[model samples]
Target chain A: MNHNLFPGFIGLSAALFAIGAVGVLVRRNPIVVFMCIELMLNAGNLALIAFGRFTHTMDGQVFALIVITVAASEVVVGLALITGVFRSGRGLDVDELSEMRE
Target chain B: MSVIFGLAAAVAVVAALGVVVAQRTLYSALALVANMVALAVLFLTLDAQFLAAVQIIVYAGAVMVLFVFIIALLSPGAQERLHPLEARVLIGGLAAVAFTVVVARLTLNGVSVAASGRFYGRLGPFAPVLVDRHGQVQTLGEQLFTTFLLPFELSSLLLLVAAVGAVYLSRRRRAS
Candidate 1:
């Protein structure tokens, strides 16, 4: 097995996920962290597809498709919420919003 | 065996690096998208056509975009903070590297998959199930409609409930 493309892809996806996770853990900015989370999700998508192909199953592909659709809808609604948060909180920093929970 | 694994390993590391190093959410999002696409290709090579498509449609397409859109909408001046993470990034990154090695070793230890991604031309062993039969989608639909209709319908209802809950959460809070 000399550099098979499938595992290569999986490896790349995993790398992306790791980076995203690091960003989430280390970044102070909420927006940046949010984006990193998305990056992680995408990485998982890649893994799913690779698994699907290897297993000769359509389930992974179908799940990926559904994920995409849900992502789109979520973005629309999420953005709206974010905008509202920004308006109220007056800043985009995650640490600043810690007060709202109480 | 080592060669193929190495390639996969290298790609994964690089893409992961890109996600961490990218300055903007858009860039990160793009990197993630690339990662997802690569996974899809990997899946295709593995002969998991169904999973590959779902990966594209569901995870890559839907989930990623939502993430991107949220960042775009909510993230204000996030780039300014990127430099801040640089302070302790070196120490943290080293740990990440160690983690990767351990996980990679584990993966290598478990599965001695065939050298080629495409071990079998078709699905089944020996001759493959080549019974066209309108493909997996059609058959899945038949199965769901006939045998697993209730679970399928319940899933839809659950999704609907989730949507409603999200709307409620986002609604403006009433002032006392």
Candidate 2:
């Protein structure tokens, strides 16, 4: 009970963020990429809650709540865009979305 | 207490890895759900009861359901494999390592436990584990409504806009 869980929490957040970043870079599937983005957001959420607890304030929690709200909206827009892309019959692989490669 | 935190963190990390490593989008989505649930437990360990509930309800429950629904709608295609020596993979691995090192170093060195010890441990160990069954929620509601009212309202407007945009984007165009 006297132990410090802060360090562990921070490290875990870092690991999760790193995993998500790698997923974003390596994955070609748009849906997988979107999931990785969500993973990164969750990592951020964990860090905010951990910091809030260690600091003993409601600021972090409120911010985390706002983040969750934003993330939900972001997902809605992202999924819609993905749906639009699917309708175009161009496939879901991000590598194939090179219209702006120039 | 430490055991609980350690177990939850381990499960969370492994599940997050699953989210990244799973080939199928559905499996990755499932892994993400596990990760979110594990994180909610971790939040509980941190005494953030309200946040834990929100994490479960919003991320694990709603957001994940949307992800799974989208994955099903997208339909499956040929899997893309990453070669070990490919430039993109190598670059991404290097970036990930660098980011992890920088973030962990900042966390260990920049933030000190002793500094926040006073505020963090104001309440003694016996300190009412629940922190007042309704106290946490009350505090959250007060701050959310008073100090953070603007952001809260803005977020609602944003959500409304996002919903409308999603519907517009997904709707089929009528033939002229």
Give the TM-score, chain B only, in order for the candidates: 0.63, 0.84
**Clash pairs detected, candidate 2:** none
> Would you give me the overall lDDT of model 2?
0.83
Q: Where does model 1 sit among the CAPRI classes?
A: acceptable
Tell me how each candidate scores on DockQ against the true complex. 0.34, 0.63
Residue-wise C-alpha lDDT for candidate 1, range B1-176, written one tens digit per residue = 44544554455456656666677657766766676665565554544455567767765777676766666666665574355346567656666666556655554543444434345334631111431445655644554576566655655665676577568657787777
RMSD of 1: 5.4
Tens digits of per-residue lDDT for model 2, A52-78: 776656777889999999999999999
DockQ versus reference, model 2: 0.63
- What DockQ was computed for model 1? 0.34
lDDT of 2 at A89: 81
